[model samples]
Target: MSYPTIPAYQTQANGAEKLSREHPVLDFLIDHQEAFDTGKMKTEPYTVFHVDDFVFTKSDGTVLPPGEASWKGLLEGYAPFNKHYHEGRYACIYERNGIWEMVGFANVYANLLVPGEKTKKDQSGRQWDVLVPGAFLFTCVKDPTGPKGFKVKSMTLFGDGVPVVGEMMKRGMVKAEDLVK
Candidate 1:
């Protein structure tokens, strides 16, 4: 899977550098930095509302209602983080066949945090405070560089049972139609 590496804004010693306005998704995150910092961002879970005729298939090929599917077994017994579950929107911009393409995703994350232990080193040896995703909803081009662009991929609704893709769309967290364009 070829995921596009979006560039991060470089910061100088004096202060944070100005971010490029070319990326809307990145711009959105920057604009809401305060909301993120203050821990006020809220995104509804996918299961709270009903969808007409929606079915999801697990990795093992079992089909079930979108609301009933579970990724609990994969989380190592860590519960979902409801208060800070939604991690906002992101975009991966890349080129294929000399054509510019963008893939967007709404990240709904589930984590487990120990009261006393606040951080752990990830596989890359970097310490992170947030629990690794017990479950997540990834939208638009799963793994990227495939024919599955502009669709919901693998996801787990552990925290609020909200489907990140659909719920984000409803709340304007992401523009579903713009993802594939």
Candidate 2:
């Protein structure tokens, strides 16, 4: 789908303009601007996708199915030390006040060693494990949220596990504070 023509100032080196953190999906939703402004647009809820479900193709165009190890390897490659569990969810993308907004959710689990503790050992010096749960809002510029978008516009962590309305009081990884609205 074609996105709204980005302003000249927003263009980057690669020419694709950067998405605004304050209104992440505004440009993408330009096609439905009228419906959004009039509150006539409908939102799709409970859309789900997984990172591991991607299918890869060879240079000659042979399709490869998704594999467990490939998915784990992707997470390992990106996070290295941390073991990651990602559950991609779509909260909704709706128009309000002449702007598009992405209200997506995700449950991410990262197995990390406790700070200042060595080898996952507890106070008793025995083996201990810790899984850091993080709740994140996954926003993008794609019309249909899927694996097609190679570049991620924004990822803001709100809290641990699934998020609730007005629960921004708790701190996690705060990327864009304005996005909580």
Candidate 3:
């Protein structure tokens, strides 16, 4: 299904571009994200800015190990989905004790066009859009030796998985029986 083009977001109080200029780290992060999304970079964003001991905590409190396996797992799980439209709703950057942290939420919708081999028959080849709001918290610090003068220590993602699964089942993207043991 073809989705409408997502318009550029602009904050009325303070433009996001202006803030990015004021915070070079934020600018670098944003630029890197765009480049990665456009296939300009094969490297993941986490490895570029995250420290050696970096961790990713899911909404369920599961802390994935810091390594290539964890990164690959995350990528493979979302390989079937693609973002159809997205718009930033809110974002803020703050500093405390020398750590610069960013918190943001975006309105996102995705399409499950490609189903993996393990996907249920009923869930395959569906042409429907699913609302998938994204919220993230990235904690980092200035690292003179790191890329772009900053390194992330951890990243926490917030989401309600139950509802997403429920929605998928309701829309036939996921079979209810497949979720049962």
Candidate 4:
């Protein structure tokens, strides 16, 4: 598929909730999500790219098939640490918006979007690595309504995912916040 479908996410994934107790960074972030006075979300990050600038060739000068690492889908390689990765959900990281905090997310798994079977060398030059393009995922978009102080927004992306969305996706993954530590 030229573009990946958006992923479905909840405030707490199946595994992320457990990890929140382990560290403060994860705890406060997950428990207390920052919202506007009416509980409107301030953050709306939605793009990701790899560290490398879409390089199809390896340092050794080898070509690779597409899907080497796609930003479009959850890379299967991350399967082993699904729980640990989900913990990233608690990471209430945000992008800068005129010095104000934006939205909070469970995790933003940004990486290289390499085609399948591509080989790339790390800075250490010790081994080959597959690249996954960066991607932005939000827990949910809050739309508060009524006196009860409630809201309902789409938790999952609707329809097919577009590789680039407006200007955000075109910007690529440049911000430190967009990447996973």
Candidate 5:
């Protein structure tokens, strides 16, 4: 078996698996379309949502942007390309009940972080991988060099990050007043 890599296709594969972000997520969403569901699906990549102050980050200790970066060169050591979990550099933000909260992550893969994982470090004294995560999601297109342009038209949600934040706020760990503005 062989997969055809179009030198010039409708969409370029910078990272995300399918042709577009909507295809997979939409497929998954179709099943639960009745639910007040606004999130990506399992097919998409994912990362973790740590219980940070007001921001969520990947396990590497660096802030994972929300979406994918157009140029691989744009991805820095702080935000690695292949190492990055979501697409573009933008996390998915949803305003629920007048709250501009981050409902999911898009730029990097969301599922990387799971519960009970421990922080691992490398010889450079920097974190290599994060073990624990609150949620996961997927971004679209990491690289594109054709007419379509490499990018994720839609982002998908996986695991569960919203509840993580909600729990934090409810537990008095995170301040809702700071975000509910």
Candidate 6:
């Protein structure tokens, strides 16, 4: 079998998977994502979220701030679902003066945890993959107390959730009222 050659420009944009491993901070984040992809978040990436004051905000103005709720909420939400980090392109990634940042577009493949009423399934009743798109910004700061001497302080996820939400609603996995502001 043969594979097509990727252009240099394209390879550079999709270098998240090829980033040099010498940088510990970026490595930390990558490790976390890898753990999530392989369904080992509960054990492997658990400590990556040790930042007690971490904040996660979505593009839709939804915010999960420190003390309001912890990463445990995220764990619970993902506990019932199977997700795999399909691909990502980090348009920008750098570190300076103890701060590390990355901005990129990512796709995650997931399936409905439970069979939905209108879910599209195969003859074997296997649900199809849901490709979730996300444009994200991750900012990390040096923290001696953090598990890796660094921690993710804030994360901003920019994306059009409508498509995925619409799909979910169609599959009977979510209701219109559930997404109401």
TM-score top scorer:
6
lDDT of candidates 1 onward, in order? 0.35, 0.33, 0.58, 0.27, 0.30, 0.59
Could you give candidate 1's per-residue lDDT for residues 1-181 as a string of tens digits?
9997654432211122233436533343334333433444223232222122224444344545443343223222223333333333344544344333333333333323322233544333443335323222222222232222222233333332334344335545458686578
Pairs clashing within candidate 3: none
Deviation in angstroms for 157 in model 2?
1.2
- The 10-residue segment of model 5 with minimum total lDDT is 45-54
**Residue-by-residue lDDT tens digits, candidate 6, 93-169:** 67656677767566655565665443333333444555566777777887786656777777777766565667678
Task: Return the lDDT, model 5, position 20.
Answer: 37
- Model 1 worst lDDT window (10 residues): 9-18
**Count of residue pairs whose backbone atoms collide, per candidate:** 4, 0, 0, 23, 32, 0
- lDDT per residue (tens digit) for residues 86-118 in model 5: 223222433234222323323222112223222
Considering lDDT, which of the candidate structures 3 and 5 is the better prediction for this target? 3
> Which 10 residues in a row give candidate 3 its minimum summed lDDT?
116-125
Q: Can you list the residue pairs that collide in candidate 2?
A: none
Colliding residue pairs in candidate 6: none
Per-residue error at 49 for model 6, in Å?
A: 3.7
Look at candidate 1 and give me any clashing residue pairs.
Answer: 45-162, 46-161, 46-162, 46-163
lDDT, candidate 2, 48-152, per-residue tens: 222324333232333345544433332332242333333333345554444333544333333342222223432223432232333333333342453333222
> TM-score of each candidate?
0.28, 0.27, 0.64, 0.18, 0.20, 0.66
> What is residue 157's positional error in candidate 1, in angstroms?
10
Model 4 scores a TM of 0.18
